[model samples]
Target chain A: MAGNREFANRRLHSLLGVIPLGIFVIQHLVVNHYATNGVESFNKAANFMGGLPFRIFLETFIIFLPLAYHAIYGIYIAFTAKNNVGRYSYFRNWMFMLQRLTGIITLIFVAWHLWETRIAAARGSDVNFDMMSNILDNPFMVAFYIIGIVSTTFHFANGLWSFAVTWGLTISPRAQRITTYVTMVIFVALSYVGISAILAFV
Target chain B: MAENKNVRFIITRQDNPDSAPYQVEFVLPYRPNMNVISALMEIRRNPVQANGDKTAPITWDMNCLEEVCGACSMVINGKPRQACTALVDQLEQPIRLEPMRTFPVIRDLQVDRSRMFDSLKKVKAWIPIDGTYDLGPGPRMPERKRQWAYELSKCMTCGVCLEACPNVNSSSDYIGPQPLSQVRLFNAHPTGAMNAPERLNAIMGDGGIASCGMSQNCVQSCPKGIPLTTSIAALNRDTTIQSFRNFFGSDR
Candidate 1:
C-alpha cells in the first residue's frame, strides 16, 4: 500500500543518514585531519583511503548512491518543511528547523566539494595535500569551507537526535535530553576536526 | 502573587467563527483558591469589561469542572491546559486566555476539535463488538500491560497536544499525538488486536507517523501525562515490522 511505501522511504532516508553517510562524514574528516601532521601525511592518508581494494565499487555503492539518495530526498524534505521557529521557539523546534536548513546547505557544500575534489580527480588531478591547500588558498574559499564544515557537522549531529527518536532508540524525555548532550558533543568535536583540517590545508 | 484585590484577565475573544479575534480585559474580585474556570464563570455572570463597557457573555465549552473532560482546554498564560485545573494562584497575573489556535476558533476560548475526533475515527480507536449478541470472554492480558494501557486510555481527545505541536497547524494534516496514542491503547486490547494491522496501517501513511518531527511538545503539553512520545516510538517499531510484512506478503 501507499502507506507502507511512504514509511519505508522515510525510514530509508533516516537510516541512510546515519549509516554510511554519517559514518563517511566522520571518516572523511579524520582523513582530512591528517593535514595537521604535515602535507605528506595528509596525502598519505588520502592516498590510503583512495587506494583501497574495490575502491570504485565502494565509492559507487557505499558513498555515491546513498549520498545521491540522501541529498535528493533531503532537498524535498527541506523545501516542504514548514518551519515554525517563530511561534514555537522551543529547543527541539529550532533543531527541527535547523536540520532542514543545514541539510540544504550541506547538500550545496557537498556538491561543490565533490566538484573540486572527486570530479577533478576523475579528470586526472591528484587529490593530494596541495589540491586541498590550493582550494583553501583564498580567504573566501576558506570561509566557505568553514561554514560548510560547520553546517555539515550540525546536520549530522542534530540528525542523530532525530534518528534516535525515529528509530525508537530514545523514547523518554530523559533519554532524549541525554542524546541532545551527546550529539552536541559530536557537533563540537567534528566541527573542530573539520575546521582544523581546513586551516591546516591553508 | 500581587497584593491587588482583583485579578485581571486578558481574554482573546472572537465574536463568531469568521470574525477577527480581539483581546478584552476583565478585572474580577479575587476569590481564594479559584481556578480559571471559576474566573471565566464570574466574567460570564457580569458581562462588563475592565473599562466599564458592557459586552456579550464570554462563550466557552465546559462540562466537568475537573481536568477529565478536556472540554475546557485553552491557552492559559500561553500554555495549553484544562482551565479547570489552572489555579489562579499558580498562574501569574494577569491571566491570559486564548483559544487553541491549532483548530478553528469557534468563539472566545473555544475551538472546534473535530480534527482529533476525525483522527480517532480514522484510526478506529475502539474495539469492535456488538452488545446484541453474547460473545465469549476475551483473552487475558498481563497485569503489567493492562496497567500501562490504562495510562494510554486516559486520553480524553483533548486538543492540547495538537495545540502544542508546531506540525499540527492548519497547513499540515498530521493527526497529532492524541489519536496516535489511542492507536496504541486500542491495539493492546485482546479483541482490538484483531484490527491491529488496520490501525498500524492507518498511521504509516502521509500525515501519519512519518510526519511526526519528534518536537516532543506533545508529551510535555499532555495534561494526562500519557507518555505520548513512547507510544509514537513504539509505533515506529510497529510500523517498521508492518512494512516488512507488507513487503514479504505476510500481513497475516
Candidate 2:
C-alpha cells in the first residue's frame, strides 16, 4: 500500500504533463500560427477562442488545475530531490536536472505570459496584432519571449517522451528511442511555429 | 585537570518509528585505533550527554564489525557509509550520525532495509536449482565473466545507493541500484539465465529501471564500487530485448 502511494503519485505527475498541458501547448501553437495570415485573421482566431462558451469554467478546470498540481508538486520534488549531475554528468542525469530547471522557468514564464495576455484580454484590453507587436517590439521582451517559448517547447517535447514511458506506452529501448526521435521532431516543429509567430509580430 | 582527548558525536535519535527524531551530543574518550562503531559502543555504555545530562542510549544495528555486513550503514557527517568502517582518525570532529532515510527508520540509527530485500525478491535475484537428484556441477563461467560477476555479487544489500538516489525518495517507488545490479549478476549465470526473462520483465515497470533518474550517485555511493549505473544501462538493453520477445512470442 505504501509502495502504491509512491507509484500512484509518480503516475499522476506524469499523466498531468501530457493530458491537458501537452494538449494545450499544441493547441496554443496552432492558434498562434494564425498570425502568419494577417493581424485581422489572428485577432479573429483569438477572439473566437476567447468567445467560446464556458470559457472561464473550461480554462479553470482543464488548464489551471493541472498546471497548479504539476507546478506545485514539481517544486516539492525539486526541493526534496538531489542533483548529482556535477559529479556523474551522464546524459540522462543532465536531462533529469534540466527537466526540473526548465519546469521552474516555464512555470514563471507561463504565469507572467498568461497574466500579460489572457488577463489583459479578459479585462477588456485590446488583444490584437498591434498589442502583440508592440509587446515584442522591445528587444528585451522579444528575447524573454524567445527564451520562454523555447523552454516551453522543450518541456512539452521531453514531457511527451517521459509520459509514454510512465504510462507503459513505450516499454522497450527501441520504442523509447523511436519515441525520442518522434518527440524531437515535435520539438522542432513546435519551435518553428513559436518562432514564426514571434517573427510575424516583428 | 588532566588533558582529555575525546571525540564529539552529534547523533539523530528517535524513540520509535512514530516519534519525531532529535539530535543529542556525546563526547567519548578518544581511543586509539577506534572506528565510529567503537565510539557508538562507548556512548551506549555510558548513555550520557555532553551537557552532563543522562539520556537514553543511542541505538543502531551492527554485525561482523567489518564492512561486510553492511548493517551499520548511516549518514556520517552528511555522507552515507558503513559506520563500522568510519575511522575516527580519518574523520573530522563532531561526527554526525543519522539513519539512512531511504528506508523507514526503525529507531535512532537503525532503518528497515526490507525494501531492498523485497525488491530482490521482486526481481527473483537468484538461480533456481533442481532438488533431490545430485546434479552435476553447473556450467563454468569464463574467468573474465567471473571477475566482474564477483564484484556485483559483493553487494550486501546496503541501502546507501538508495539513499543517494534522487529517484528513490520517500515518495518514489524506484527499486534502486542494488537490486538492478544483482539482476545483471544473476542473469549472467548459466542456470540463472533460464529465469532472465522473468527478471527482465520485473524491472520493466513503474518502480523498475524506468524510475531511474540517472543521477549516477549509486555508482559513487556503493561501498563495493559496483558499476551500478552500468548494470542499469545493461538491464535497460536486456529489458528492451525482453519486451521484444514478449511482443513477437520469441525468446531470442
Candidate 3:
C-alpha cells in the first residue's frame, strides 16, 4: 500500500514539472525579445528587473524556483522513465523523442548562457544594454541562439497544442482543429518575436 | 459485371525497428460482407501473397475479437483505427495492412506497448483498493461528474493515440496521450480522487506531460475518439495549481 502511494507521488511530481517549466520557457522567450532592442536595452532590462518587488518575487518563485524544481525533477523523471522504444510509428513519435532530447540540450544551453551573461552582472561591471546584441553578433552564439530558439519553439508549441487538450480547452474534433490552429499561430508569434530579436543583432 | 475477381491488398511490412520496411501485395477471394479483420483472417489462414507464393503467416495481434477491447487497432488505407470496425465493403482496394509504426514491432504488426502500460503505472492510474474491508460503499459521486468519468472510462489501452502522437516514439520518453488521459480519468473519480495529487505528480515527471509536443494526431486518430487533448489541458491547469501549492509550501 505504501509502495503504491509512493509510486503515485512520483507520477504527480513529473506531471507538475512540465507546466512551470513550460511557462518559464515562454516567459524567457518573451523576455529575450529585449535583446532585439540592442545590447544596452537587454542588459538594462535585466538589471531593471531586479528592482520591482513582485518582479523580484516572480524571479525567485516563478523564474528560478519553478525552473529549478522543474529541471531537477525533470532529471529525476527522465532517469526513472522506461526506455519506451518502438511503441509508435507516428512522425510525431520521432518529434516527441526529439522534443525531450532537445529540452535537455536547451536546459544546458540556458545554464551556460546565464553563467556567461547574467551571472557576470553580479561583479558590478559597466552596464551594456547591448550585451545580448553583442552575443548574437558572434557567429557561434548566433548559431547556438538559432538552434536554441528553434528547438525551444518546437518543443513549446507542440507541448502547448497538447496542453490545450490536457486543460480541457479542446474537447472534440472541431475543438482540436481550432486548438491546432491556435497553437500554430502561437508558435509562429513566439518564433517571430524570438527571431526578430536575434536578427536585430545580426 | 459477373465478377471483378482480384482482391488487391497493399501491406506495409517491417522486419525490425531499424530495418527498411517494404510493401507486399496479396489477393483474397472476395467474400460477401467481409470486414478488414475478416479479410486479415483469410490472409492469415492462407498465409499467401498475391503472387500465389506461400509465405509467413501475416503477423498481427487481437484479443476479445471485438472493437470493445480495442486490441485490433491498425492502419487501414491511410487512417489509424481499429481494424475490427473497418468493413471491406466501405474500403477501396488494394486494401492496406500496416503495423502502426508509432510502436516497435515485436514481429510484424505486433509492437511493444509496455511503455504505455508503464506510463499508467507511473501515474498511479488506478484507485487504491487493496480490499482490507468493505469500506462502506466508498464515496458517492454526483450524476454529472459520474457521466464525465464514464467518458474517461472508455480508454481500452489501445495505444492508437500514442501511435498517433508525435511525441511518443522509440526516441522519446514522452509516455504519450493514453496514459496522460488515464491520469485525468482516475483523478476525476471520487474514490480515485484520493490519489489525484499522486496521478498529477506522475505526469509531471520525466517524459511526463512536458514532453508532449502535441501534434494533435492522437486526438484525431483515437478510434474511441476520447478527448485526449482535453485531459492533457486539464492536467496543465492541475499541475500549474500544484506548482503554486508547492511554491507556497501548502498541502491544502
Candidate 4:
C-alpha cells in the first residue's frame, strides 16, 4: 500500500510537470514569433510585456517553478521506472528519452535565456530586439534558436499528445493514431513558422 | 541446407551516446547454431567488417542470456526480440540489425529506458509492502487469482509493449501496457487489494489504462506471454466501477 502510493505520487508529479510546462512552452513560442517582425517591432512586444504591472513578480515565480516541478519530479519518476518488460519499438523509446533530455535542455536554455534577457534588462542592459537581432544574426545563436524551437515544439506538442494518454483521453488504437498525427501536424506547423522566421532573418 | 559460406550482417554502430552512428557490414563464417547475440559477441571480439578493415567494437545491452532478462531485446529483421533467443538457423541471411528506433540509441543497441520505468511509477504498479515490523503472514491469494496474477507479475520491463504501442512514441505521455498489467496484478491481491481503488483511479486518470491503444500487440509480443489485453480489459471494468464510485462519492 505504501509503495503503491509513492509510485502514484510520482505519476502525479509527472502529470504536473507536463501541464504548466506544456502551456508555458506554447505561450512562450507565440511571444517569440514576434521576433519575425524585426528589432524595433520585436522589442515593442518585449517592452510592452515589461510594461505590464506586476509582470516581474509573475515572471519571477513562473521562471523557476515549471522546470523545477518538471525536472526534479521527472527524475524521481524516471529513477523508479521499470524497463524492458515488453517489446518496445524504436519510435516509442526514442520519444521517451528525448522528452526527458529535451526537458533538461529546455531548462538550461530557459535559464540562459533569462540571464540574457530578463536578468540583463533588470540590470539596465537588457538585450532587446536590436541586440536580439544582432545576436540572432550570428550563426551560433541562430543554430541554437532553430534547434531550441524545434525541440521546444517537439517538447510541447509531444507533451500534449502524451498528455492525452496521461490524462486518459486517447484510449483506443484509433485515438492513439489520431493523437499521433495531430501532434505531428502541430510540430510540422510550428516548424514551418519557426524555421521560416529564422531563415528570413538569415 | 549446407552452411552457406555467404551470409551477411549489416549492423549499426556507435562508440557511445555522444558519438555519431554509422553502419558496418560483416560476412560471418556461417557457423551452424549461432544466434544474433553470439554473432554480436563474435563481432565484438573480432572488430572487423566485410572489407576486412579494422573497426570499433559495436556496443549493445544484454543481461541474462536467457530470454528471462529481456535486456537483450532489439529489432531482428523487423521484430523486436531478445538477441539471446534470436537464432541464426531460423533467421534469413544478410540479417539487418538496427537499434530499436523507438529508443534513443545510447551507444548502439542500448536505449535509455527511463521512460518505461517512469510510466510504471506513474501507475503505482507495485504491491505496497513495507517491512519494518514482524507482522504475521500476509493474506493468501487464491490459486485461481494467483495463476493469472503470476503472469501479470512477470513483467520484466522489457518495453516491447511500449514499442508496439502506437500511443507511446517520443512525443506522447502514454505509459503503455506493461505498467497497466502491473496495476491489475497489485489491485487483485488481498492486502494489495486495499489500494485497488487508488490504483484503478490512477490508471483511470492521466496516463492511466485509458491511454492504452488496445492494439493487442502487448499480448502477442510479451515474451512471457502475459495476458496483457485481458488485464487491460479487466482494468476497463475496474476503472468503470471506480468512476461510478467517484460519481456516487464512494470511491474509497
Candidate 5:
C-alpha cells in the first residue's frame, strides 16, 4: 500500500539521480567544457545537442521529468533529514549533511540556470557564447556560477557513493571506503571541469 | 596503580523523568582492571561526592556484568558502549558518563529501550508457529547461509548503533538500524521466511528502511560488528523486488 509506494519513490529518487539526472550533469559539463577550446567550438557542441531530433520529447521526459521528481523529493529528504554531524562528526556523517546542503544549492542554481538559458532560448534569445559571456560579465555572477558548479558536482559525486550503497553495490567497510576514495576523485575531477568551463566564459 | 590514588568521575544524573538533569563528580579509590559498573558500585557503597558531601546514591541499570547483556550501554567519554566492558585503565581520566540520548531517559543511565522492543514487535522479528499440534522439524539452511545468518544474530538490542546514527532521535521515528537488521535476520530464517512479505512490507513504510540516510555509522558503532549497512542494502534490493511484484500484481 502506502509503504510500498514510499519505498518505490525513494528508490526512484536514488535511481533517477544516477541514471538520467547524474548522466545529464556529466554530459552538460562536458558540453560546457567545449568552451575551453573557443566560443565557436562551444557553440557548435551546444547547438548540436540542442538540434537533436525529438528534442522536446527528450527534454521533457529524459531531462525535465526526472529532474523535477529528483529535485522535489530531494528537497523533502533534505529538510526531513536529522543531521547529527555536530555529535558524531564521522566522515560519512559530514557527507550526509553536505549531501542535503548541496541538494538545496544545486536546485536553486539549476532553476536560475534554466531561466537564463533554456527558458530564454524558448523566448527568442540565442543560447550562444556571447550569452554565456554576458552572464559571466558580472563578478557576482561569476562567483555564483563557480559555487553553483562546484556544489552540483559535489552533490553528484557524493551521491554516487550513496547510490552504490543503496543499490547494494558496496557492502563491506573496505568496499565503502574504496568508493569514498573513488567518489572523492570524481568530485575533484568534475569540479575542475565545471570551474574551468565557468572561468573560460570570463 | 597506587592503592591510595583515586579515579574522578563526572556523571550526568537526573532525579526523575520529569526533572532536569545535573552533573555530579565523585572520587573513588583507584582499583586495577576496574570497569565502569564496578566503579559505580564503589560510589553506591559510600554515596559520597568529590567535595565530601553526603548525597543520594547514583542510579543506573545493569544485569549481566558482561558485555553480552547490553544493559550497561551508555556514553563513556563521548562514545556509546557497554560500561561493563569499558575498562578503567583504557578510559581517559575524569571519565564522563551520559545516557544514550536516542531513547528517553527513564531515570539516569536507564533509558526506556521500549522503542527498540516496540520496533521488534512491529517487524514481527520472530517465527510464528501454531501451538495446536506439534509441527515437524524445520528445514535446514545451507551451512554457508547459516554462518552468514549467525553474524546477524549477534545483535543484543543495544542502542549503540542508534546512538551513533544521526537519523534516529527523539523527534524522528526512523526506528534506527537495530530493528531493520532484525528484519533481515528473521526474514532469512527458513520458518521465518513465511512472513517475509509482511516484514518487508513493514520496513517499506515511513520511518522504515527509507529513513536510513546511509551515513553508515551504525555498522561501525555496532558492538557485535553486525553488518547493519549490509543488511539495509540487502533489504533495499529485497524491497525493490517486492515493490515490482506488488506493482505487477504477482503473488510470488
Candidate 6:
C-alpha cells in the first residue's frame, strides 16, 4: 500500500505538470501578449479572465490548488535530492540541477510577481502601462525579470521533457531525442513571448 | 629509493556498525604496481597508524583481486569505484578510502550489499528455469540482441552505481541502477521474456525507475560501463507499454 502511494505520487507529479500548470503557462503567455497592445487592451483581456463565472472556485481548484501542490512538492524534491554535477559534469546532470535551481527561483519570482501585480490590482491598485513601464525602468529590475522569466520557462520546458520520460510517455531514444528538440522549441518560443511582454513594458 | 618512498592512505574507520566514523592515516613503504588493495593489505599487516598507535586491523571485503568481482568497491579519492582497479600510480598522494554509504556499513570499509541483492530478487532478475530433466532446446536469441544483453550481464552487484546515485539513500527506497539494468538483461533473454510482465510490474512500483533523478552519475562511476542510464530510458518505454497491456488486460 505504501509502495503504491509512492508510485502514484510520482505519476501524479508528472501528470499535474502538463495539465493545469503547463496549460496555465500557455494561457498565460497568450494572455500577456495583450500587453503589447497597451494597458487598456491588457486590462480587457485580464478582466475577462478575472470575471469568469465562479471565478473564485475555478482559481482555487485549477490555479491556486494545483499550483500550490506543484510548487510545494517541487520544493520538497529540490531539498531531498542531491546533485553530483561537479564530478560528473554531463549535460543532463547540469540540466537536472538547473531544473531544481530554477524551480526555487520561479517559486520566489512568481510569489513576488503575483503579489506586486495581480494581488495588488485586486486590492484596487491601478496596474496600467505607466506603472509597469516605470517598474521596468530600473536596469536591475529588468535584469531580474530576465533571469526570473527565463528560468521559469526553462524549468517548465525541461520539466515537461523529463515528466514524459518519468511517466513512460516517451520511451525510445529517438522519441526522447525528438521530445528534447520539441521542448527546446517550447522553451525558446515561450521565452520569446514572455520576454517580449517584459520588454514591451520597458 | 623504495625506503625513501611511502604510500599514504587516509582510510575512514568505524569500530562497529553503530560507531562513529573517523579517519586514520597510514604510511606504508612504497611498492611498484600497488593498487588500493595492496596498500590496504600492508595496513592490515602492520595494524598501525602513521602516528604509530596500534589499532584493530582494518576490515573490508575482496575476493578476486581483479575488478571483475566488484567486492572491493569503495569510494576512493571522493569517487565510488572498484579499489582493485584503482592503481596507486594513477592516484594522488594521501589517497582517501571510505565505505559506500548507500548500504549499511557492516564494519570499517565493508558494507552490507543485501539491499542490492534484495532488489534483484524483487525484480526477479533471473531466468526461472526450475524443475529437473533436460528440457528441449530453448528459443534462440538474435546475435544483435545477445550482444547488448551481454554488456548488461557484467553487473557484479558492486553497489558502485548505488553509491553514486543520490536518490538511493537511507531515507529513500529507490532501487538504484544495478537492478534496473538487470531487468533489461533478463527481459532480453529468449526464455526470460515469459516473465517480462512480472519484472516490468516490479519496476513500475515505488523505488522503481520513477525515482531516478537522472543525475547520470552511475554511468560514469560504473566499473563495467554498463550503460545504466540507457537501460533506464529503455525500461521507461517498456513499462509504458506494459501499463497499457495491463489496462487492456492483454500481455501482448
Q: Per-residue error at A143 for model 5, in Å?
A: 3.2
Model 4, backbone clash pairs (residues 3+ apart or across chains), number: 40
Ranking by DockQ: 5, 6, 1, 2, 3, 4
Candidate 2 chain B, run of 10 with poorest lDDT: B236-245
C-alpha RMSD values across all candidates: 3.0, 7.2, 7.0, 10.6, 2.3, 2.9
Pairs that collide, model 1: none
Q: Which is the leading candidate under lDDT?
A: 5
lDDT of 4 by residue, A30-136 (tens): 66677777767767877777687988666655546656766676554443333332344445455655666566676666667677766778788865666566657
**Candidates in order, interface RMSD in Å:** 2.3, 5.9, 7.3, 8.4, 1.9, 2.2
DockQ pick, better of 1 and 6: 6
What is every candidate's C-alpha DockQ against the true complex, given to 2 decimals?
0.48, 0.16, 0.14, 0.03, 0.58, 0.55
Q: Worst 10-residue stretch by lDDT in candidate 2 chain A?
A: A1-10
Candidate maximizing TM-score: 5
lDDT score, candidate 3, position B85: 82
In model 2, the Cα lDDT at residue B52 comes to 98
Chain A TM-score across all models, in listed order: 0.98, 0.93, 0.73, 0.80, 0.98, 0.92
By summed lDDT, the worst window of 10 consecutive residues in model 6 chain A runs over A1-10
- lDDT of candidate 4 at residue A34, scale 0 to 100: 78
lDDT of 3 by residue, A39-152 (tens): 766777666765667866676765677667656755654444333335444454454466566667767877877776657766654435456656767798888887778767
Residue clash pairs of candidate 6: none
Cα error of candidate 2 at position B103, Å: 1.5
**Model 5 regions more than 4 Å off:** A50-57, A119-125, A174-178
TM-score of chain B of each: 0.96, 0.96, 0.93, 0.92, 0.97, 0.97
lDDT of 1 by residue, B59-158 (tens): 9989888789889999998888999999999999999999988889898888898888989898888898877889878889989999999999899887
Cα lDDT tens digits for candidate 3, B72-152: 778787676788888888888888888877777776666676677777788898899777777777778889978877888
Per-residue CA lDDT of model 1 for A34-101, tens digit only, reads: 99999889888989998999999999988999999998887766665566666567787788888888
